[model samples]
Target: MPSTILRRAACLLVVLAVLAALQACSSGDSKTGAAVLNPSTLSSTIPVTRAACTPFGAAPSVVQAALDGALNPSCEPGGEKLERWADSDGTMRDACLFEPAAASTAHPLPLLIYLHPSLVGTDLSLDVTNIRSQLETADLSGDPDRPGFIMLAPYGRVGTRYYPLPDQDYSPGWDNWYRQMLPDGQERRVNGTTYAANVDAAAIDHYLQLVLAQGKVDRRRIYIMGWSNGSAMATLYALNRPQIAAAAVYSSPDPFGAFNDPCVQQPVVGKPKDDTELQLLNPQLPIYHMHNACDIAGLCPNSLQLRDSLASAGATLIDDHIIDASLKDVAQCNALCGTDPLANYAGLDAPGGYAANLPGYAIGTVNHLRWPSSRTVDLFDFLRDHPKP
Candidate 1:
């Protein structure tokens, strides 16, 4: 990497401070409260080395043991740091962890491992992204007085990416785990750093086990919500670890992978040719996939292939969440079909209904929708519906 780029990376904290100041100005309450970093800006900052992630100079074992009982699950809001692991390089890595205060020992709580989306941008850094909103709104259970939840949100990369793209370095060892294998063999780490779909998944597993050992968690209820690249990561994780309650993925690219189409210069869309391993894991694992009719990158052509493949591999229910809109701009869309063009299509399956709805004069792009309306599809309710049954 160039000296300029390294310097830029090192200046992450400065960027964070600027963002913090800007956020303070925007919120109008400069001195009070904290930053509000949702799924979009979570990638604003990140730890350079794995060791730097471990706070306080604690060893991995020490960190794990100290954090095992760090949380108290409860209906009332409460949380704590789960774990901090430092690699041998003395280069530490940090993480984002939040848990609702312990409700009661007798009433174990559910755990929701939330994965933020990826922002393919310049340098990565740990910012003053005030996570107050995340802390308050992390619980999607919909019951204010309901049992609490354990929400773990891992940071995505602004420099590299959350999931493997056509351009990033992915290890060959992850071939079976990740269906999107590159033609040029596996992806190698740059400077001993391995960033792949499984990397985040593995971290989730480690922290989840720590909480599980505490015995205050309900092993039966563990859910995951992933958007964009995070969606790909969550789906890939569920393939092997089916026991993760119910999962909801949003803004997923077409076929089996990719952020932009022609990924890595070649589009790796549709299901994998060899999914014998996925078939053995838990064919009945039903995952919910929501996307736009005309997807982004190059996933538009065979967007439904992922859903179809998952069904063939053993998913019982693949709920199709599609955002139906004309390929034209807002003006053009309204001129041809009028406002609420998709309102007429009730409970329409994405691939089919969306295709049939296109006007004869349609000309433009039709990609993924922001989200399937909660009235039509509530992913949170879906998660609650499945509890390790």
Candidate 2:
């Protein structure tokens, strides 16, 4: 048997080795055959050009004004389209509220939380007209057959990157907060941009808490949808929070290597070691994952992996459609997959085939990133069928 000091030294070596492996995977690069990011040079905010939000106008400002008008009905008392809620870290977040035009007095309506991609914050970051046009094309805003539902799209912090530090601390020159963990299992406040402990999850919880207090929401019928980074966050939130009945995520990556914590024994992809800080979420949350085969940001394979993970946890995999570049083929693909293909494959001409080899998941292809209106309808239908118990 080894002495106590030797045992401790061995444990330290094992921890260092595991951390080194994880660092390499997270950074997408490696040094001396080890993957890791330069911890000392970590910055909170990365510069990203704000997406254009022009709607029926040449200038961005004009489009923003139009979006404001659409979201905030002129007849409302406050004349405010959004209600703001603060998180634990004192960050004031806003959510756009869309009340149904003719809600029945007896039935409380379902709520759908829409999370935008990491380009610009708010619904107006992209061309307001373009976004609105897309929503209209999807039939999400004006659907006569669906239940009366309220839509809320919350704005995340305006930064290109997200940090997953152990706790929250403020640093000058960095707009976001970070948390640091000491060697003794104590959390310390470090000055700089650190990782948020599931900032998306915390933000949703904050929004839900505030909405519930208003007494207009049906607690069992909350649904979520997100794009890109927002999509990944949405999936994470649904997996961890039982209140969410269903979720839709598009073009997102895995969350395994992003954080600095150890893994928890839930239901993750690989057989992650016992010391990892990432937890395996075991809830049976319904999820709709959409991705394009040629997605430049997140590869289609990653989305398949996520779908497989969800299925392993007993969640229903409603449908997975892959988009290629051939229009004719895309139509055929949608017909075969029982979902639309042209919506996400906006530019491509549908040539690629479905990634059917992905384990424990369904796969399809489209030409681009915009999923069809039918896909959205299917997701909402799934949410309606699986109310929270």
Candidate 3:
């Protein structure tokens, strides 16, 4: 009887040992499985469809067709004119196109999309040609040896109406005209001004398609620039489209929100709380942001906030400048209420000021709107230096 009892005890001990060993193995497997399922380790497999290649050197037919498509006119093509392209929603909008003087060499020319200030009274037709000429004078294309490039200035809608009198009725802001939406659903101004539909993604895509069809533009060299609200839109485009090589924004506001928004956890495209679609779409693009110290339109703080957000997302801070002093030109200074001068660091400590902040960015300040001769020169130089990574 004693021997039988001992055998039973030994058998029970062996069974318990096997169960413990199995439990240990199971725990180890679970840990390994968890490690494999880490979010960072998961690869994004979405395939991107690249636009058709347009070589630097192409037949005249291809080039002409592209020019024709981009500059399709409602009336006979005469002097430099404002033309409209329909958006996905079938809304017509305005865009200005300048064909580079016929190049002697086949060097592919860069295409620059210049966005205008939303508060400007005139459209692209009024100042686009002059602006292009100024850019050329600045030698913005990097080298005279190269083919130079084409310039396209798209008009943005006004956000508000300027009342000659302060007590007069309100006017439409630029965003309202561009988006065709009310401000937080407000009413339109008496001016009845609207943005040309061509500035939107659909219209921009069509314009790109026309460029691709021409087979002369360098797809890798497309760029964007804008001022004020237009600058904000340019940043939005760069954020949403991977094809844009680089961007230069002047006096622009933050697209998503202020710099302190906690939702902007990182700069890697999709990590931000707002505009997830935009972040996911264009993860690897460069941005150049510029702002003044005393921007009356609230552009200074907005630009700084965006710079911080972009830095947090692992974006390369290419160039940054803050102009706070009064302009030397008495007339220009007076026009800008003496805000033309670039301010010192002390001048930026006021409410919604930008001073002592941006990391890994080039900051500067100068007189206001000196055109391609001054601020634009610096901006375009930065763009030429940094291409899409």
Candidate 4:
């Protein structure tokens, strides 16, 4: 064959090779035929296996100390292992994880992150709420369809302030919100910009990422709950993370900075600038807010205002229930107390101790500390029904 003929044959082969390479590249695109060649698809399909958490031995003592308001407290819930992760600021943070035996990659459990209140840590919160028991019951129920949950209770950093109510208790608080008194005495609001710089928020985000990496979490059913100040944290977290399925809180303070003169008198709710601030909350997210009638911080009015505000913003679903705290009926304890009417109020200062017995403070503290009685509402049922759509 002539040289020209050989060269023409080589050119034809090179053109075919180029066309084949182009076809391969096109197929690699996520929008094209086979996702096998796509890097995104490959990464997504690969099963992630994180090492099982090591069990922390000193769980019981830590719990008791927290309940008694010990000067130094560390969070380690009973039977649950402590998980430590570094914050964005490189400070190590602690979390207690209660993973059900049924939790596996094949049967991932719904993840519920519990944020503790101002003064106490994870152990006390879990103890008082009895949420761990509830989860255990569900897991051991022998029902395949209703697998239990994996709870991750992350510890908030201890605050600098010395809280002096019902005797001095060490305060471990979240940076999600901070109250500031306005110029006109008695009015207070959460510092909008300052609270945004929350380091705990960053740490909580990292905590979530670590839990998800374990492969035993159902991402769609991720929920958060909090009590008192922690409830405020939950509100901010849900707002920041729209992917959250729902938020169920107890005695949340004014999250929107709308309430003024809290606890001093009847809190007055004022409108936020425009509706933009209020609309930041995902309208589709289900919120179950339970507040006691006579709360110490006067938070009931705040809950009512938030409910009305969300409604005006076209929120898809929000359940707000104000439990009647006036009646200390043992019947209303919902088995939280066994034959003793005051069992629900255990560990708290007795009725006449210090200033805690001041009128409403007697039973008011009990009502605030206790969860909404199951007779009034079922929080678990609400959580089970609402997954991220």
Q: What is the lDDT of residue 313 in candidate 4?
A: 57
lDDT value for candidate 2? 0.43
TM-scores of all models?
0.50, 0.52, 0.55, 0.61
lDDT of 3 by residue, 1-389 (tens): 99999999999999999999886665331110110112232222222122221110011111122222343232113224444665443445455566556422265666777766543422432253244554334444566765456666554332221211120112211231122111111222212322222134444555555554565555567788776556666776665455678888766656544222212212354432322212323544677765665443233554566676667776656466666543121111112221212221222223223323221012322222333335566667777776544
What lDDT does each candidate get? Answer: 0.41, 0.43, 0.44, 0.53
What is candidate 2's CA lDDT for residue 278? 24
Which window of ten consecutive residues has the lowest lDDT sum in model 3? 53-62
Cα-based lDDT at residue 165, candidate 4: 49
Which candidate's TM-score is highest? 4
lDDT tens readout by residue for model 4, 238-329: 75455577888887764544222111111122222322232232446688877766554334555566666556656544687666665232
Residue 223 of model 1: what lDDT? Answer: 74
Higher-scoring candidate on lDDT, 1 or 2: 2
Error of 3 at 149 (Å): 2.0
Q: What lDDT score goes with residue 133 in model 4?
A: 74
Give me the candidate number with maximum lDDT.
Answer: 4
Tens digits of per-residue lDDT, candidate 2, 1-389, equal 46988999999999999999886577542211112323344222322122321110011001122332233212122113456655444545556555565433444567777666554344433333132233212333233554457666665643223222111121101111121211111111223323334343455555556555566666667778776556665666566455577776665544332211122122433322222222333246677666665543224554565556556645546356555533111311223332211112211222222232221113432223344444555555555666666
**Model 2 root-mean-square deviation:** 17.4
